[model samples]
Target: MSSFRVKGGLKLKGEITPQGAKNEALQILCAVLLTEEKVTINKIPNIRDVNKLIELLADMGVKVEKVGPESYTFQADEVDLNYLDTQDFLKKASALRGSVMILGPLLARFGTGRLSKPGGDKIGRRRLDTHFVGFQKLGAKFEYDSKQEIYKIDGTNLKGTYMLLDEASVTGTANILMAAVMAEGQTTIYNAACEPYLQQLCDMLNRMGAKITGVGSNLLNIEGVEKLNGTEHTLLPDMIEIGSFIGLAAMTKSEITIKNVQVEKLGIIPETFRRMGIKLEIKGDDIYIPSQEHYEIETFIDGSILTIADAIWPGFTPDLLSIVLVTATQAKGTVLVHQKMFESRLFFVDKLIDMGAQIILCDPHRATVIGLDRKYPLRGIRMTSPDIRAGVSLLIAALSAEGTSVIDNIEQIDRGYQYIDQRLNALGADIVRID
Candidate 1:
């Protein structure tokens, strides 16, 4: 395993361009199975999870060729459906949560899919019951071995119908949407996750001739099509990484610019940071953050202390709550962070507390941060990453701390961010990777 050793107290400057969205890239890659023609995807992030998904695609007889630094051509015309049952396929599929998306296209195009339980950050018990229930409503039958965690899905012709997801699970929503596009009848999905990534998926599917409506809302209406054709699509820039960069610039008091951020697609992200009193300048597709001395936490309407929380769609994304919490540690005021989605996500505040952050862990899901206000910088300390978001949060914390800090379990960071150390170093961040 590798770790990041950082000499902190460095002001990161210069422009950094974010790679493609990892979530969107994974869903787009799986959509390749829906067509026989060659699909070229540009700006795909070269990350561990993406590489694992590509390997899974290759194992299933899909031809993937790297045409550029962050571009690939994928053709699934010669897929072997039986490859899903192999141990290698099972291992790779079970390693990431995005693997569950393969089930939809696989079952839709090939009539069946077999795989093991999917694994990801152990934030909470993310149930696939919503996914299976939605698929079953669309004429798919699912059988699973609880002991081995193997799942088998079989269906003849997927017939779309009115379905309501119990929870707006992101992957679950994507899986059902993929399946419904090629179904026999009209599919109406209520309480769907309409995040930017899902919106991109819907847009790409429509480009490939799948009829979908309500692109940015909780209710999605998809018309089942007989076939989908291949098309070249460019993935959206990583909004989560863009948010992370914004926080890093604020904490380190750096003047930095983020390039090619799809300003229109970043729903509620820039506004959420603005609530923290961080001003941003938009120059076309780029976001510029000038040097900042302190961030002020906004108060509620009734003049009460402000508490920022995360919700499903059109709300601040739950993935960014960790970065918000760490950024608050260096801000000028106090705020309570309520993470409703994941239970274990707030546990990383303990590491921030060890670095002299004034944090009160209200519970497993809430934390109150008292900002240092430039009166004191965080002290460097050794910490282990618990998951992907927390790992990157620690890296952000380390960048603003004094002296040296070591962050272990960096593979967790590798699962999401592509060439993170190199990219950050280009922005004048003092980070080194060590094994």
Candidate 2:
């Protein structure tokens, strides 16, 4: 297992550019299977999960070419449908949660899609019901083999209709939308996830001949087209990474500028950090967070304790709650972080507590952080990364602590973050990867 030996108590300075959105890249990469024409994608993050998805595509006979350091051109002219039934396919696809996305495109185009139980962060139970149910609603025959833990979907004669999702799941919406793009008729999806990345998918599909309306709203109307063509698409900067950088700057008392952040799509992330008393400035498209000796948390208008909770898009993202929880450690006041979406995310607070932060693990879903006001800096210790967001949060804590901290299982961090140590080292952080 790879681990990170992070030397703490160093301030990082310099401009860092956030990588391409990991979440969006997964959806966009899967969409490449919809057409046989050449589709070029830029700003692809060189991360483990995204790289694994690309490898899966290549193994499935999609022709992939590297055009630049962060650009790739893909053509699915001769996809091997037989590969989907192979044990190698199950082994590769089951390891990636993004693999489930390929089902929609494959089902829509080739009439059959099969997947083993997909794997990802073990944060909590992320059900595949939404994806399968939405497919079933689109006239696809769904069957599950309990013994093999495989899902089979057949869309021989898909004809779209209306669907009101039980939840606005981002991946679920992307999967269903991809299938609906080439269905026989109109498909209306209410309560759809309207995240910026999903909107980008809709825009990309529209550019490729799919008629999709309500680009930024929950109600998406898709008029199915007979075919889709290839188009060039550029992914947005990862907002989660941007938020993590903001937290890192505040926690380590660093003067850092995050460049080309696509500020308009960040959606209340900056303001949410400001509510934690962290001072940041917006310059054109970059975010400048100045160093601070101490910051404080804000209270509600009625003078109640501030609660930082995650909601659907337009609300604060759940991905950053771990960052927010860690950033609140050195602030002046206390804040309750409600991780509504995932139960196990707040479990990392025990590690922060070990680092001299005062945090109360109220339950599996919530944590109360009492800021130390920087009076006593966190002292580093040995810990293990549990999930992607929690792993990055622990890294931020280790960076601000006194002395060196050894973090095991940093592969979790690498899955989402691209060259995190190298990038931070450029900004003056002292981190060594012990492979």
lDDT of candidate 2 over 81-157, digit per residue (tens): 99999999999999999999999999888889999999999998899899989999999999999999988888899
Task: Assess candidate 1 and give its lDDT.
Answer: 0.91
- TM-scores across all candidates? 0.98, 0.99
Q: Cα RMSDs of all predictions?
A: 1.0, 0.6
lDDT: worst 10-residue window of model 1: 81-90
Clash statistics: count for each candidate:
0, 0
Query: Model 1: runs farther than 4 Å from truth?
Result: none
Q: In candidate 1, what are the lDDT values of residues 1-435, reduced to their tens digit?
A: 899999999988899999999989889999999999889999999899999999889989999999999999999999997777788788888998889999889877888988799999989877889989999999998899888789999967899899989999888999999999999989999999988889989999999999999998999999999889999999999999999999889988899999999999998899888888787889999999999987788888897878889998788899999999999998888889999988899999889999999999999899999988878889999999999999999999999999999999999999999989998898888899999
Residue 361 shift from truth in candidate 1, angstroms: 0.9
Error of 1 at 175 (Å): 0.4
lDDT of 1 at 332: 81
How much is 424 displaced in model 1, in angstroms?
Answer: 1.5
